[model samples]
Target: MKRLRTSIRVKLTIATLIPLVTAIALCWVVGASIITSRFSSQALYTVETSLNSAHELFLGEQSRLSDIIRLTSRLPELAENLSTSGPTASVAPLRLLLGNEHLSFLTLVDRNGLVRYRAANPSFNGDSRIGDKIVSAALKGAVTSGITVLQAEQAGRENPQLPGKMVIRLKATPHAYTSSKTMEERGLFLVASAPVLGSDGKLLGAVYGGILINSDNRLVDRITSVVFQQGDTDARVRGNATMFLDNIRIATTVRDEQDKPAIGSLMSEEVFAAISRGTKWIGRAFVLKEHYFTAYEPLRDLAGAVVGALYVGMPERPLMQLRSQVNIIFSCVLLFLTIIGVTLSAWIGSKMTRPVRALADGARRITAGEDLPDIHVDSHDEIAELADEFNIMKHRLAIREDENRALNHTLEQKVMERTAQLEEKNQQLLAAQKELAESERLAAVGMLASGVAHEINNPLAIIRGNAELLEMTATLDNPANEEVETIIRQTDRIERIVRNLLTFSRSGIKRLSLVSLGILVDDILDQVGHQIPLDQYRIVRNYRDGEIEVEGDEGQLRQVFTNLIVNGLQAMEGGGMLTVETSLNMAQQQANITITDSGPGISAEQREKIFTPFFTTKRDGTGLGLAISYGIVTDHAGEIRINGEVGTGAVFTVVLPLRQKEVDELS
Candidate 1:
């Protein structure tokens, strides 16, 4: 098994990051733990404080009821009427007391515990007493303050329940035919009692008054308003206050999940049990359908027995959300720190490896026998000392290399001299081999052309002789004379094709002369005009309005330009420009003629075979014209080449060496 290789940078990064990541992870763990614990504690404290505030307001309300009841009993007019007149008393003073918005129910009972007056139900004044602990105690001449569930028909039970003030139905109800007073259980009240005595302090009757907190308003709203004030926390999340009589939630600002008043739901079993024991349960508890950070305090009777509980709860969702937001902020901070650590790690890695990389590169250069610049040893360290030693070794090696080069230089000179002589001989041998191959190729082609020409010449001679006979012997108006004329023309074309093949195969010579290329091109075009559709093309002669003389075979040069021009004209199937340009090539001591056409151009593949004997692009071509033309140009010590692309057209250039002797004669 192979272990992977690492550079100095990787080692440095690993060494740095292990401790960095470990420290960060440790810090993160500790921070999250501390933050969550603190949030839990602080959040509970807020809820408990709210609960305490609500409880204080509730107690104050109880005291206010106590004050109203005790104050009414002390009224001088009330004591005088009740004592002198009893059950049939005027009772106008008690009516005035019940008018207080805070007071929900008010009554006066005689010493026999019979109702003398009822403020809530005025027509039922002589009804049986509203017997609760406070009322009972009050009738017994003992002043009391407490929460008591008034008897049916006492706490406005006899008063018809309005259709609009419906509570959530929790229990089974009596039949519709059943009397509402017989089946209904009235809700709880915060009541106060004080004995009504005569002016002599003799017990005459008792005044019982209370504020009903059942399905009640303003009182619970006041508790919530006092406990939770507006701030960063939303009022809905601040949650509302609730009071429960035993298991029944009687008066509340708390709402169900639907946002309606949660007037009929019970407390969680844990919270209910704890409050039933008359102790505060402070923490998270499920009530209704949601969870809250809550506090529950017992609501006791005047005898100091727990009969109900006062509760304040703040919804847990907001507290948990704030906690999550804090955690996210810390997480983002951790992420930023991690990114910084990674960046610093990379920088430190580079710093550690940079010098080592430079040293390795320098060593490689020296080992390969390359001259090296001096390395600066800026550090006062062992690495710097090592660089100094390396520079000394490099200097010694450079000196040794110089001495070795001097010795090798003389030996290399002798070898180069011998190698040059050998290369010259090799070139001479290759030239001779090429000449021999060419001579053999020419001999074979000539033999084949001579045989084919001889066979065609016999028929051509017979055809020409017969045409002459017809021209001399045939009479005018003979239709056969026209056919005979056509025969002569066709035979002449065949004869030219045979002549071209022979010239190409034999590499034939011609009479050399100083020729005007302009006159020669014009003569060739005049001859071609009769054979081709010359009127279908635009002939552009750009011969520079002067004569440029060149040393060449007059007959062969004419054939070359003629073939080029005719090929150009024939290629223009849709009728196009045919240009013949002649110029002097002063630089190369030559005269140039160019024939170009606006026609479907020659391609690279076709150009290669254009001057090859027996190869042609045309359907009825003997393929000998350009071959003979190529041979004739080469024999005259001149050059010819085709230039073309796929769609632009073709230009054939013939460059003939100028005659220096002819130039001197002309001058």
Candidate 2:
């Protein structure tokens, strides 16, 4: 009896505790996933908000600097005195002007790319660092902006005498001042530059001015003081933020801790590369042996060229400590819940086991073929009722066994019939799904075909008009001949368009061959350039020196380039610049060809549907250009990336892997 009771107790205990344990385990897993996801999302939001704030600050500073440059350029005495008195005489006034809290070092570079004058104490003298790209660009009436690690000689000081002297220079055209001369001799530099126009609206020169970031300016001190302030009594945290001009770290509150100024320290390769690529980055970085979450953005001058990068960083340790504290609190709560659940399960299991064990023992006696024994129950409960039922069941078992078998057979037959019905319904559902897919495909194809047909008709009309003009002027072979030739070329382009349409509509892989990209791009440009209105737009090509070869269908690849170029032209309805660049992406082992357009950029919502057939933003657009181009590129096992900002313009980059010799041979 005791053995039978124990068996029943074990079964009941397992039944009660298993489900409770499972529920607690599932709850823990779900809770952890939710908390982790929330934490990650919040972290990303905080970073994005901080970056936006930093971007606004950068823009404000840029505008303020531009204003200073404009105001200072109008000062007639300063320009006249500096120009006529040679390089040495300009130092005193420059030093006085730079004495202002916001002004940095003053520089005067000539058109021949020479730093003719600098304002640095007794070391002020004329130095010629001619043939520099910035000076050349400035001479050509363009603002040259970029960050560079200033060497001792390139620091704008004549003697290189000033210890740890570095400056971020903005070179611009000088306005019409009394000392105004040629574009080269009159080039001005301060911090920022503004174009100076004469009363007659004639171009004169540019004026430049800048704030000295490294000096004991109150602005820097104030920002640090507020953010690093601790409790009362004027105490503060020992933290600092520094500014880097070019690759050189110039100004910082923490400079005193270091043995030497960080003014000439070269930026890390990663940071330099990002700035060069015009990309802004924000993340944790180790600077001066301390980890900081740094917000970095490229600084641009009036011409929208990146001159320098601004970095605002705060120590990451404090934020990490806070995160750790949160994690600890969460872990403790989870641990407490876990302990409670385990304890409750143990108590409930013990309570359920006793009655279950009694029933189990009674069942075992019947299995042992003993005369049925009456079960004695301590409590009048469900278990006691079950025990009485078991005794009755054992008495009637021999008589009811045959009837039970027949009932089970009938249930099995019904289950088989229901299973067959479910299978038939599943097949019908699958067929419907297939038909829906086919309908979607046909809709897509129809839209693409309609747009392609419409786009081709316009060019076809132009071709026809040109041919008629040529036919009428057959006898005249001068200007009219040239006009006829131009017409024939346009007609050929229309034919190419029709060919691309047919290729796109028919979905089949074409034969590919190993082709040199340099030659391929040149050939496509020769054809597509004639189609675009070149007078309104400029095409800037930035292809690498070496051959970029890949396995692809030449005709199909030509269609892809044509489609992209046409799309870019269509985007810039009012005419703008188009930049096509090619380079090897070493990490990805692919050649990246990027087409950038200086037009209103694509929105995020629009970008999602850009490759979909027949989706277009333009009234007269066929939209199949991008869709067909996308298909061709995908067929070649390549990836295409489209990225843009609303006002900044758009870039479409295609990455195709380099073809191996073996694969090329096989093709």
Candidate 3:
């Protein structure tokens, strides 16, 4: 084991594995810490928020109940009539009133602590605690209120011998009629109670009402339903929430899978204790055999006593799923970073080792006095530069070796040539001198063509300008309009021909200037407009919405466009469309202008030499048009290309750089 560990391969493996393992371990530790802290904080915040919302909802329910009570109390006639009428007559009107108010039961009691009237079905006979807490308190002239839990089974048994059964009970305090009685003997009921007062500010009687909290699970279920819906389903209440009075469960909105009620179940001890403190609590706890993040807030009565609690919660499955997804993404990122680091380290190590090996080999060759070969290295870093310097040193040694070989060869030749050679060498030198003169003569003739082209260009420009001025000023109504226009047009054509000649002769301006392509196109079109039949050809312009400026000579570019457009018009003897489009080129800081013509396109064989000087297909054509255009554009550091198909016509694309100043500012 020790020997295996000490091996170089094992050591290298350990070195690589140790760091990667350490990094992965650290990533997991950090990720877990963050996840735990953030998840706990988010859970706590969610619990607190839900508790607050439940408290507000409970308070709203109390306020709604109070509003209904107040509305009932305003009917002083009903209270007065209930005190005077018999039990049967009073029961019908009271039942109607209770039904309208959405109360489960309504009752009226006398001051003697007896139930005089009851609105609910299945009579109580005033046997229960009819005038209990509320009645006693009201008799003493104190407004009394309290909520009570009523079991449907127990309450129903009281009326099992009657025609129908009552599923709930109600009780009131300080009976309606005036009588002497102790508060304890009033036989008050186990339900909510309220005092019925008269306008004279005297205690008229009491009105008691009770709702089967267990039967009204719909309200709590609706409150606990999720506010937002996802996927294809609507939001729903997923978990149970039970209202607890003191330590006992009063009612619950929980339902089984079959939609059967799961009420009357004992409340959890932890949740009960939390509510008893009169402070809100929330955390992961089991509800209906499933774990959830449950929120509980104490419900307070008018006197600020803890009467019950409102509970709301949701399952933690969604949060667990989210945590799993985050872990997967983190793992992927770590793996990607690890791969990149390994690749970079290996590449750098190889890069450092290769040059050192080459440098050592070159040094040995130089020491041996052998002709050294060139070494090539391709990095713009310090190590590459060092290798470059070493190569230079090797090159110097190789030159020295060559010179020594030449000197040795000369010495041997000298010994052999001593007898007879001087006369023959002089005759050979004369023949070489004669050949050099002939080459110089041909070079002089080429220079003459450029000079002649320059001399002719100036005269042509002068004649063209005068002819244009005359045509512009001349009246069109004159009988000589056709003749004069022809002269002007022909002069412009001659000037274009001369400009091409100058380009072929290599005698035009060498300076680049900012020239707007839009203006250049307009000038070229104007010069060649009359030459082409207007009725036969259609010209289309698709220029972009700005000045298309480039660095080139305006006159030379105008000559280029003039030649292209005229050739396009002549190609389609039957006439066709000539489309010119312009836009900016992204990578090349230049303007791209393309001219396409719907004419018989160039054949593949003719396309190759189309830009060669003096290569024409027409009898009267000088064929210098495209060639000179190509040369002039090339001189401006621009590119021109021709794309054509046998049947689909041709497209010529010219790309010229923007002026240096514009390019610099844009950059």
List TM-score per model, in order. Answer: 0.51, 0.42, 0.44
Clash totals in order: 0, 20, 17
Model 3, CA-based lDDT:
0.61
Checking candidate 1 for backbone clashes, the offending pairs are: none
- What lDDT does each candidate get? 0.71, 0.59, 0.61
TM-score of 3: 0.44
Q: Per-residue lDDT tens digits of candidate 3, residues 344-376?
A: 656666666677678778788778877767777
lDDT of 2 by residue, 541-571 (tens): 8887477888776666766776777788778
Candidate of highest lDDT:
1
Global lDDT for candidate 1? 0.71
Model 1, span 211-306: residue lDDT tens: 666677577778777777645333456667888776566677776567666675666777777887889999988766667788888888767888
